[model samples]
Target: MSDLIEVRNLGKTYRKATGLFNHKEVIALARVSFTLQAGETLAVVGETGSGKSTLAKLLVGIEQPDQGEIWYAGSQINCSEYRKTNQFIRYIFQDPARSLNPNQKIAEILHAVLRYSTVLSFDQREQKISQTLRLLGLLNEHANYYPHMFSGGQLQRVALARALILDPKVLILDEALTALDPSLRAQIVNLLLELQQNTGIAYLLITNQLRLVRHFADHTMVLHRGECLDYGPTAKIFANPVHEFSRKLINSVQY
Candidate 1:
């Protein structure tokens, strides 16, 4: 399979005020490079402030890198140009409450996305929405309620449904399941696997959960201090990690 996405020598820096008077430059990503083959799911694991989110932002074109490049398909994408074509890339954020609108009913929310992406008539849109909702284990009645009316797990399902409704080629999940209860997390993970199997969409899953990565990811990358300290097939990396940071991360996973 050809590479669906390629990131090369990516770097980003943030200027910060030091103490009360001086300025400091914080490097968020340093010479990061990787590739995602079509339909492959890659998990990136790191502690907080490890630049995982920064990398996600860059990949999704929310932030421009100071150095290097990101190529989607065969072309190097200009940030703005990429955003214009971003229908193929969807982001599932960490907080469902914040990601969803409190005022919009689930039906309205999904209708808007379908309206934007496809030219389906009202009846077709409703049919699609109903099928998508059921696929995510959401009841048809729930679609008439506000976002706040649902549990955290249900809200996350809504988020996933919204993303999948677009039929995106790639989905970036930034700690999306971390906010859910453990059993709910397991359900969502299984849901993700089912979606991938059915649709063959690529996933750039960012998480702090090593256990989840072990169970769900095809490949895993360990980030530390803005660099990829280790990465490989999930099974091999977990079985014999060479880097101390990677070892610590693998050990930290509960059971």
Candidate 2:
């Protein structure tokens, strides 16, 4: 399989605020490199403040890396460059409340995205929106409901449906499943696997869920203090972790 996403010598630093003149810099990601092949699912596992979220932001062009290159397909995209057909690189943020508009109905929210990003006509958008909602196990009756009216789990499903409406080639899910219950999480995971098998879409799963990583991810990368500590096939890495941080993270997960 050809490489779909590539990162080389990636680095990000945040400057701390100072009173008068001098300020210190906090490094988020330091010299990180990896390759994600087409149709492959790579899970980025890390604890809080370990640069996992930072990596996701960089990939989705939310935050620019101070140093490094992000290559999609064959071209490199930085904070300044848009990936080839970049709109297909969809990002599902962690917080449903924050990422979604509370004032908009589910149908309205999805329709707006489809209208702006897709070329589908009004009738086509309606049909596609309804199909996506059903695929997510949501009914048309819930379509007119505002986001705040739905439960957390429902909001998450809606969010996933919105991402799918674009027919994305690469889905960057940043802790998107963390807020869900275990049962719902399993269902969503299964849905993701099914979608991948059917569409050949790749995923950059940014999560701290170690067990899920072992089960669903083809490749796994562990981060600590803004650096990659271990990366390899999921089974091999978990079966015998070479890095101490990887071992500890695996152990920390409730089995």
Candidate 3:
């Protein structure tokens, strides 16, 4: 149960144009710190504009932090280092259709990622692709089909297949379950838990879904306006939220 990822005082800022020649700095995240352990799911919950996505971006190296450091496996990493080392960490987007290529077959889409991320031979790549597809409840022949041929749930599984194909130590899911229906969401959540149990891959679940946070996450971190409002064991936070914002968020959930 060692720490897989540690983020310390992480901060990001963006400049937006106020006028023709005027601009203002927007604090997207400020002094956010958290630790994700091996084989654990850390749910990040927040309202819109609360810096959840910004935190995910920084975690996966999609954006550079203006301040603070990110450490993976005991060493600090800069943007460039993260780029090279990112095979150990993978990102799954909310919109599987958009994240996938319309022009390529599913096999081709997976092959592209495998080809660039690993040195597996063609035959090895194909076998790995088939194996991963089956793991996600997809058939080998399904790889010949296009992204448009699949439903939203299937497309999300395809995305998961691609992400897991890398055998990453960490998976950053940015609103990845939001697009699915309730039943599909439950299935995916169960699938995620099963995957973690089997592979020991840690998950950073960036979501606004408090129910998922309660069910799937071992720990929960609450963010508001680019700062940490509350963070602790998911059960404790849900049962008795210490922060007013956390209480409001939990109360706002319809179920």
Candidate 4:
């Protein structure tokens, strides 16, 4: 596999009102660096304020970094290039199907993406929708159903279908599996692994699920209070965490 995404010295800051005439700069993420290879899985783990979401936003073009360079498929991109980046790197919100339109059928929801993102005609769009839906183990008929009609596991697949519909090269899974029960999470994990095996779609799994990271990720990035505390192979980091904070984090979870 070759480098698919490269992030160098990424940083983000936010200004919050502190007083009547004063504001404070809160560094959400700073000096973060990493690379993701084609078909590779990189798990980003951190606490609430560790800037995991900030990193996800930057990757998907939802937000721009204050300082740093993001390279995709060997070319550089900034916030303004989000629409272009979006076609290649897709994001799935943590709320699962709730991110979907309650009033729209699945087909309509997916059709909207194809209708705008590509020039595919109605027939092509319909064909692509069938293929994408089936790719996530959903039937074509389900596309006509509303999100509320599906079970929790099925809803997760619908969300996956939305992201996969674009045929994106990379997926920024922004804690997408957090809400699923363990059994459902396991099924989704297996499905994702299968997809990666077949499609070579890389994943930037921004999540707090260390167990998932330990078993599923090729590498792990540990973030703490807007800083990268440690980063390395999953086995190496789990067996011998370099930083005290990292050790504490690993110890917090049961193997």
The sequence of per-residue lDDT tens digits that candidate 2 reaches over residues 24-128 is 988999999999886799999888999999998888877888888888888877555654344678889898789888888888998998888778999999999
Going through the candidates in order, what is the number of backbone clashes in each? 0, 0, 0, 0
TM-score of each: 0.93, 0.93, 0.97, 0.98
- Which residue pairs does candidate 2 place in steric collision? none
Model 2 misses residue 164 by how many Å?
1.0
Off by over 4 Å in 4: none
Taken over the whole model, the C-alpha lDDT of each candidate is: 0.89, 0.87, 0.91, 0.91
Candidate 3 residue pairs in clash (backbone atoms < 3 Å): none
How well is each residue in 55-169 modelled by candidate 1, as lDDT tens digits?
9998878888999998888888886686455778889899989989899999999999988768899999999888999999998898899998988888899998898887788
> Which is the better candidate, 1 or 4, if ranked by TM-score?
4
Model 3 over residues 87-188: C-alpha lDDT tens digits?
Answer: 898999989899898999999999999888889999999999999999999999899999999988899999999899989999999999998999999998
| Over 4 Å off, model 3 | none
Off by over 4 Å in 2: 78-86
Which regions of candidate 1 fall more than 4 Å away from where they truly are? 19-21
- Candidate 1 worst ten-residue window by lDDT: 79-88
